[model samples]
Target: MNDQPAADTARRLTTQEAARALGVKPATVYAYVSRGRLTNRRDPVGRGSTFDAGEVEALALRSRREAAAPAGELSVRTSLTLIEDDRYWFRGVDAVELASRYPYEEVAEWLWTGGPRPGARFTAPPEALAAARRAVAALPEHSGPVDRLRVAVAAAAVTDPLRFDLSEEAVLGSARSLVPTLAGALLELGAPAGDGAPVARELWSRLTAADPEPRALEVLDLALGLLTDHDLAASTLAVRVAASARAHPYAAVSAGLGALEGPLHGAAGRLAHRMLVEVLERGGAAPVVAEYLRAGRAVPGLGHRLYRGEDPRAGALFGRLADLPQAAPALAAARDVTAVMARHGLHANVDLALAVLTVSCGMRAEAGETVFAVARTAGWIAHALEEYQERPLRMRPSGQYQGPRPPQPLP
Candidate 1:
């Protein structure tokens, strides 16, 4: 017992060490800090970073238990992609490179209709456009764009003609019509007219507010480009599952949205933004760090699961954000928080960076969610098209029950 205190005082571990002690991933460790679920003090060199070894062990021990189900049985694999390596290939081009040059609409068009007008405008079969519009209009008033999008997908599924064929035209048409419909419904509360206007143009008009500035459009475009796709995230996987089941485009997208609604997957940006604001609102990073240490509360937006080291994308965007006037303050604070956090040596994830971006743009909490929904629609459509090429019909998993055999034992 005496040795314990001596050892703990002598040796302090980084957040990585603490994560290992807790048998959780390093990212999970950062999440704990962000959420105020765990606390660690700073080292002498830094203001607030050093964590007590004993505290970590106690937390880890408290969490450890027998598996809920045997490991092998519990580990089910699917086609859900994570895109941990390499660039997002939009058609044949790299997404990161293209987004720097093209408008968000172009990227969206590429994802939906295939690289730059390969064919004629995808016109959804006559009644389908009207039905999509009606669905949008029907979304309860004052609903969020993303929520409205989810509802619209559900409503459109029933009325979508050519849903069963999974043909190229059907997929492309669905992409064009649905994107604008959701954009209009969410942005304007008006349904799609399915008129002569180009899908991209209509969507851009609706997405912007009245009296928008030059930068606002640019920001919107940039945000769209940023959120577009992440290889095979949970939402994209959901879209694939629906596609594999031969569900139509709208149904498939609805599936993706369902996955996005989960806290762990898509709500990350919102969570990070809230946490950062709380830090700023209470009294900058120092006091916030102090209180966090005292309370054992974790900080948000300071970590990632995929990037064991650091998120390259976060680093890249961080550099570019120096000039944006609107998002500059939040961006600066993020920089401060990140620099200060290095005493602890944890890196920022996309969520953290995006939260900063969101704040810089002066968007509502809901806007983050909306951005995710809109950006991911392109991926969902792509996945749906992929599924169409695969074995259609039902792609749902089979259930195998494991329980005591009943009648024979009784007999």
Candidate 2:
């Protein structure tokens, strides 16, 4: 066998390739995309973005990675889709369509069950869910809601007798119990727990905007459905990696949660909201792009790993902007930045839309990541369940490093 690898098949890249070739990140390539300065076309296979080979070469001449990067073998293939590009499809249904049209709860059912809602009504055991809900409800009102939610999950796993079962029914029930309960806990802590209501509904009410339009549930369902799962993101990958080891659901969720807490995964939504305001407050659209460029930061909501040019999800959510009149300030900023930035080569993603959603709904600025945590828990659970049943190996690899051969002295 030859030691030298064959030429790479990834000759043509989309924005990311060009960006990589440009000695910058993909988001910078997004700047060029938004500017329409480079030549690009659709990825014929999945209808995502594709980069031009010649353009990539041109930019690669100046790239830092041109010589240092070496080609390698493609090793593992798994059922998970990490680094998902373009559309988020679950069981072959487009996630963008779902999030735009369905209620959040309905989306949860679909994600947890991996099947459309069958019967008109169904019931899960209330005991675990109620306990989980009560636990979350006790968090301090001013505490980080997401952290409190994670703690409640850990507590519930410790308290519950059935946490180790890992059966399909058990996992599903746990999901139904956990998500609703987490949301409820936040609401109760924010307002008053068990004041006079069923906990789940109270949380949902708090999560949603006060003046929802007639189609609010439909919109939430669709959004939740859209976000519930995508190809394996970093958070999803962490969940799947944990699950691949037959880790407990709580453990898997914890791994995923840790990943999501990073700025790369969960901070985008809040950043978009804040950035839009900063742009508007400074000097409208004129200074927004320049400020980001000077700071060497990408416009938060405008670029994506999967969407080559315009993010389809962004377009879908943009369609809903008309429904929210109260978000004018943020909207104006979003519109101005989007308009100006597109001239350079970027399109908004779910983060941008969600930022708009948060602003329009009168939701607190801090709630963006919390909402994401709530929505993404379903996927984490599903992946965990899949890992519990499917993978043969748990984990075995360990590190070997140079060290003193002598054993450590006892204290």
Candidate 3:
């Protein structure tokens, strides 16, 4: 063995060399230094910093070690939408403001194809609506709303002969028709097409078991607009994964719906709804919340990973419920829950607001999820469209193997 200092043996690299070693760009190397993730020493005779190869290698190993799941440390570039600093933005427009001011279709138009023109009103063809209705009815009574929606999408896809046309115009045209069609079918609205009413109003008429009030209708519209898109969610990732394979929009949307069906993603609304019911029945938020914590279960709808404070969408939706006289009790229970969470430094999320909307409108327990799926369809289409422009099949991530090595021959 040769005697040598550890520093003398450790290799040093320029910024660019370090980037290559890390399998990233030079800017990323700088970023790693700025984030204090890697150490950088100033170049003795030149401009930029130099990285210790050992440190860079250590960082790469740590990155791999920490990323235990598919979701860990993955980043994708997109100009479609953003969720940062507790604010959601679609093409730089504030989503909270757009939800209160504009229709969801308009929001979808901006997401799918960037332009100044507002999209045409969403109207479904009679045949497509009929096809979707049959699909929804065929589902078992135990099926969730998302299940019916998923089946309806598949059924509609089978009915459209031109669904293979993956052109942007064709795909967008289908999306515009499909979302409203799915909503109408779920509500069983048998009205003629081209009626001059907001799509949310039509949906509200079907979802609310009681008489539809203006305030409730407004809340539905706002909710739809706010939920239209979120950046790189699980369902959106599924949509992009399918789209990267050059799948047709319908197939891509089906993939999204499939991913969204899980309880952790789209079905959080149902859990939140159940929690609200328990809170209201127990006469306050504390007892039910206490029981949930004692059992080591998280309080559904009480917190989100993204938002540092309250979810802005939750704030927007819940604030509007105040004007409606019918939403008083549900709203009160929701506030109680928020208050209890606040003491522990947790905040309410959009799921809680959606649960409040579900209960206050006298809709079924799964209505919030249905609304979420329908609204998120716009975002899926947007993501698919964006993915179509990218090099196909680029989402293939490298797998790190941990299995045992090949056995020795004749062992």
Backbone clashes in each candidate structure, one number apiece?
A: 16, 20, 0
Model 2 clash number:
20
lDDT of 1 by residue, 1-411 (tens): 334465676777787788677766665565456435577665656554666767777666544432233343322222323344533456556665666567666676666655574333433444554666677677666766667678766666666666565666767766766665565545442233346544433444554333344554455556566567766677877787778777778888888988887877777678778767866686567776666667886666776656665565566466556656666778867877777678777787767777776666555555567666877787688777755654333344445668766665554
- lDDT at residue 374 of model 2 (Cα atoms): 75
* Global lDDT of each candidate: 0.63, 0.63, 0.81
lDDT by residue (78-195, candidate 3, tens digit) is 7778888999898888989977887778878877777644555888777887999888887787988778888888888887887888767888889988888777777443333246
> Highest TM-score: which candidate?
3
Model 1, position 166, has a per-residue lDDT of: 69
Could you tell me which residue pairs clash in candidate 3?
none
Candidate 1 lDDT for residue 138: 73
RMSD vs true structure, all candidates: 19.4, 14.8, 10.6
Q: How accurate locally is residue 117 in candidate 1, as Cα lDDT from 0 to 100?
A: 48
Model 2 CA lDDT for position 290: 84
lDDT of 2 by residue, 1-411 (tens): 123223422556766556656655555465455434465666557665767677777655533333333333212223323434565565455666655655556665666655677321223245555666676667776756566767767766765676777777777766766665566545532343243333233444666546444444334444555577665678877887777666678778888888877777888887887876677578686687787888998888888867776677667766766565665667677878888887777877878877776776656665567767877888788667655543234332334557867788866
TM-scores of the models, in the order given: 0.67, 0.69, 0.79
> Which sections of candidate 2 miss by over 4 Å?
1-85, 118-142, 188-204, 207-218, 280-283, 394-411
Return the TM-score for candidate 1, rounded to 2 decimals.
0.67
Q: Mark the regions of model 1 whose C-alpha exceeds 4 Å error after superposition.
A: 1-92, 112-114, 117-145, 157-159, 187-210, 289-298, 343-345, 393-400, 408-411
